[model samples]
Target: MDLVTLTVDVVIALWVVAVVVGIVRAIKARPPRLAPLPEQIRNRFEVGWERISGRFLYEPQWAVGEADSLVMSLLSARGQPLDHARLPREMQQARHDAAAAANGRPRDKTEAMRQVLLQYRTVFERNLGPKPRRTAPVPRREVA
Candidate 1:
């Protein structure tokens, strides 16, 4: 065969091989499996928050501890990217503050605890969509 014809045939063969490989890959490809929060775990989160807000609202130390636990659980479940070490560092500091407060440190760390809660909430909301609204139904009065 002529040189030009031979080159054309080789290019055609390479194109065919590439097409076959692509088709095989497409056929074998599978979507990534997301680890969604299980219903039971979600229930635990709701209950934990309710307890913190209802009974521990005035107790800054307790509230921050509970919120921190919830945030950590969420991050663990969602498999958050750990490329930057900042988040973990912040979490560790928050945990230490909570411990200090729990041990009855002389200085009041309520403000620091509140900041931790705020940061935890921001992270939680960013990872898991918006938080569901928690509201009580109003009672309707019977008209005479």
Candidate 2:
């Protein structure tokens, strides 16, 4: 009823509305979960990974670049953002190291390239790895 009380109530109500709006906006802005990769595409990625790993011993730098490319391809198939900043943190780091190696930067050390390949593997498996099988539940036995 009082002027001071009314002013304080209005401020509190406005603050609450602002907070709710912010939360809703954040929820809407989040990216949707990636759908499962099709079997054919998954198989192709697996074969590519096999070749990359096989070549690692003989050509570490090339293998790392291939691995990064494979992961990016997988992400593309899944409709993920290709922008470096928009990619997942693990992917961004792997991509950075892969670029460095390809450009002959200091991080192009053999051991570092190996680590980059491993990082790419992590992303690859997360997106294309075998999904867990679901077993059917046993039916209940009838009482005698």
Candidate 3:
């Protein structure tokens, strides 16, 4: 019984120490330097901006759908890359599309963003093709 009590006390003490350490770390940690956050967020916009070769825009899944033509049209009106000059409008349209996708039922906004991301991921998979490549079957050799 005494052993159990001592173990419990040690566990509690560990938890308290952990919480204090977390608090100290949080206070001392510096916030990451970032560009000013835009007023709105667009679907897959961030992903595209971050990629080296830019897998976000050219890939199949990230490719805009028929319903998402508004976005493409807007991008076309701007320049090939949809330059940051029109970021505000682009973000607005993205939010509009997000709302349209949600329909009537209330959903988590983050989930909507994730859905948009997944849509692009599907495009990526389609464009990239299956992971394991298929090869032509070889004819069986006859035993000598």
Candidate 4:
């Protein structure tokens, strides 16, 4: 075979190898599918979320910290990436805001805490499923 033809064949082979390696790397980089949490665990997280949300009005800073912790716990329970660098953008931002609020860095710490709560809420809803609906108590009939 001519030198030029041999070189061309070698280049094609190298390109094919590179493509296959890239595909393999991409597949390995993807996160594994997360299994659904058990019903009891999910309910516990829901109750925790409610308490954290309720505390937000009275103690914004403390509530933000609790919310952050709860979110991290939920993610951990769900086998999610826990590293700050690997966490989703929204979660990263929420963590940042929570830290800021806890450290009293922001001028409007309450507002910052509120945003953090909202971001964490999104994460909670996504991972723990939607918040359960609360039905109003039915009125009792008067005795005749």
Cα deviation of 108 in candidate 3 (Å)?
A: 3.2
Better of 3 and 4 by lDDT: 4
Every candidate's lDDT: 0.66, 0.84, 0.46, 0.83
| Tens digits of per-residue lDDT for model 4, 1-97 | 9999999999999999999999998886676566678778989998999999998889887787888889889988888878876676788888877
Clashing pairs in 4: none
Show where candidate 2 strays beyond 4 Å. Answer: 1-10, 28-31, 100-108, 131-144
Query: Candidate 1 clash total?
Result: 0
Tell me the deviation in Å of residue 22 in model 1: 29
- Candidate 2: 10-residue stretch with minimal lDDT: 99-108
lDDT of 3 by residue, 1-144 (tens): 699999999999999999999999886453323232232333244344345124434542343343244344334433333343433443445545555555534445434545665543443333222334448799999999
Give lDDT tens digits, candidate 1, residues 1-144: 999999999999999999999999876453223366766676677677677656455887768877877877776776654333434556666666666666664465665666667666665665554445668899899999
RMSD of each: 9.9, 4.8, 18.1, 7.1
lDDT of 2: 0.84
Model 4 stretches astray by more than 4 angstroms: 100-106, 130-144
Q: How many clashes in each structure?
A: 0, 0, 5, 0
Arrange candidates, best lDDT first: 2, 4, 1, 3
TM-score of each: 0.46, 0.71, 0.23, 0.74
lDDT of 2 by residue, 1-144 (tens): 999999999999999999999999888667657777877777888999999999999989779878888898998888887876668889988877777766665554787788888999998988775764658999999999
